[model samples]
Target: MRRSELVLLASFTLGLLTTRDAFAWCRTTTTQGFVPTSEKPCDDTGIPLYWSTRCVGFSVQRDASRWIDLATTRSVAQKSFDAWKNSSCPADPVSCTGSFDQGHPSIEVKDLGPVSCDCVEYNGKVGNANTIVFRDLAWTECDGTPKSDADTTLALTTVTFNTETGEIYDADMEVNTANNPITTDDPPGRVLYDFQSILTHEAGHFLGLAHTNLPQPTDKTKTPTMYARYEQREVYMRDLSNDDVCAICAAYPPNRSAPCDTTPRRGLALECGGGDPETTTKSGCGCMVLGQKPSGLDAVIVGATCLLGLGVVARRRRR
Candidate 1:
């Protein structure tokens, strides 16, 4: 399916925009049922897929010699990449091992040369340039003239990822350094956005996940982590929730239907109380049958709520 269509399907299934959190519902769709072993995309269907394949490598550059501190820029970029790698492959044996068994790809960043609008063309597209060069130029440099403008204007002043090539390219132009010491004063650090956060989000896109939007047009509620716009410093792209993990696994399940052993694997219902709904419901009903009182009240409430909601849902389904 097209990327846009996938995003729409995800929004519809989750009933919310919180993409990562709501993706848990995606596995419930009948269409997502087991692909015939022969039709599995990866060669080794026995293993779950890994994130390594998404981010193959990165290229970093800045304008002019003094435009930015190469050391600091490189450090932040490396840290961001490492954070994403570690998150994808935690030290834990269970999580790490399972992901590794899948053919996840790895990524590395290189210092490409400086960029100049004089020799290059900016079509407002990224990944078009295999090498990202930083030019000590400003927007005015590319305004009309050529040679004189090259030294003043910056080109491609944003960090963008090419989904086709799995490459991250950043150009330092007209970046607001303000309080950012790494790129303020002196030559000025021209990073367009927070390096760590933007990379994190772009990495998500590289991993075969698409932007998530709010399910209800009027809801005005933000979807989960995979939401298109970046709003909070805390919601880094590197962080993966239970829903994220499940989506990856569902898209690439292990051989022989090993079933994820971690907490609340796919196919399990999410309880309102934050535990397994199936277990909670079964136990709650058992308690009621056994003449339990106050303790069972919570379960009773859950059951009633579920029934009422289910009735409404069922009616809607019928219609």
Candidate 2:
């Protein structure tokens, strides 16, 4: 049965690919329960998260600071994690409907290479480090200076889980040079800000998924990269919708594929100086939970005179 594998099994029974579904998340508070006490994470009713971890490492930050360039930010963050692991299902990633390829995704994203420190630290720790950085010149929001709010967030993803066992451990993503203008180059109108369509909506919050809404009414001009914000030379939030494939098949469904060890239980090291607080509390860790977006606010606002220079979340549109 190989007429090109029966035309790839009739393109998966004629769904004709290019698909996605409704999905939403970004919340906290766990001990083995849903999270969403709502203060932010772009809170619209946050309470659907995943990543019980098997391996995660997205490192990048090798002195290409304040001007952005270090092999085009690690080649568009590995094409935004291969647009969710090549949209799964080579042999049935749970019948792969996509949206981070539904469940038993066995969480894997290791390339954990470069490092000169791009902190997302969780100091109450023993393990951490999952990053992606770019903030040339300057840009800080989440009440840490540099337009400390009032809309202008182009990109920012931060997740630090386990208020009781949602277990994320760490997460970080920031992109937004000073004020605007960010690129991965696909030109046409060139208003910039399409670095792999906001690194695939910050890799859908680096895999805990959230910010979805744009399925029932048809009035969002354009939504779902997890749905929060996108517009301005708008590069179509780089795919995934059907409510983000029904929110990763209702949080990691995909018929439980196993045998994993993606290798990054939590990593970080190129030098931040460690000397054993148990090997710096269990190798390369960091997380603070201050995210920004195209300005979709699910988390931010912490100022008692906090101002860094690089620590971002910008791109505010959807009002």
Candidate 3:
């Protein structure tokens, strides 16, 4: 199937958008079975996916992008994560009336430098890297197969989580510099996609947020950072709106007592294939050789992209 068709199908299968408020901020969900009868805040489909930890580490692909340098790419990435990381949830009382103040989201993003693996992958039994790669060559599948929306997709994010529990294991982002002209310019010139805005939106997906509104939103002021589409030279998504803040805060409420460790789960795997030698030793497990997947895993990969026509890249079933 085409990328767009696959995405539409995934949306329908996963139920595209789920929100508690009418403003349209939604968290990405995966289905295992049915919701429980008791009201422990269960999603109707299955479970809402989220990072179970307070600190998350992300790495930029070592082969950054042909269009932009590695230093700039890394810099833009930190700024993008900061757009959501630094947001003040529940709207400060000073800015708006009748609003209560809540602390920032209970999450901290750390830059784990660059890695050799540009592919969107998650290792169940071995080491893995939460990566942000730029496809300056072509927008193809992880195995190099051509994608139907190669020319249209701006970026994509792949999130791996336990299907049974909705706890995210790893997330990787791929930017379509192959087809899109990404700019670091403040206004992003005509038809040039803003790099910061694109990464910020992808970061939302990396953090387990689905699009705020499916069919285009009419309220410009309420247009969230998680909106599924991007317009030419549009940089508005670089900042989080009220809806975006609410969604993130709801997913990760401020908890000062939460442990803050900025390490990628299972340590860090820098290469595309096989685990990091150090990581493997630390975890006391063998590295994946020749791209072989470990057996008996219950994890599923759910990807949410930045622009329209991007699909959920892969969903690995149990072996």
Best by lDDT: 3
Candidate 3, poorest ten consecutive residues by summed lDDT: 280-289
TM-score of 1: 0.34
lDDT of 1 by residue, 206-294 (tens): 33333332232242222333444443222233354433444444443332222222111121111112221222221131111111112
Off by over 4 Å in 2: 1-93, 96-119, 125-166, 176-180, 183-190, 194-200, 203-205, 208-234, 242-247, 250-319
Alpha carbon lDDT of each predicted model: 0.30, 0.50, 0.66
**Minimal lDDT window, size 10, model 2:** 300-309
Off by over 4 Å in 1: 1-55, 62-68, 89-193, 206-209, 214-225, 232-319
- Provide the global lDDT of candidate 1 against the true structure: 0.30
Runs of candidate 3 with Cα error greater than 4 angstroms are 1-23, 32-43, 91-100, 188-191, 214-222, 274-319
> Per-residue lDDT for 144-251 in model 2, tens only?
545333235666765655433355655667676666766666757554567777778777666776555333225543455665566656666676544554445445
Model 2 clash tally, residue pairs: 43
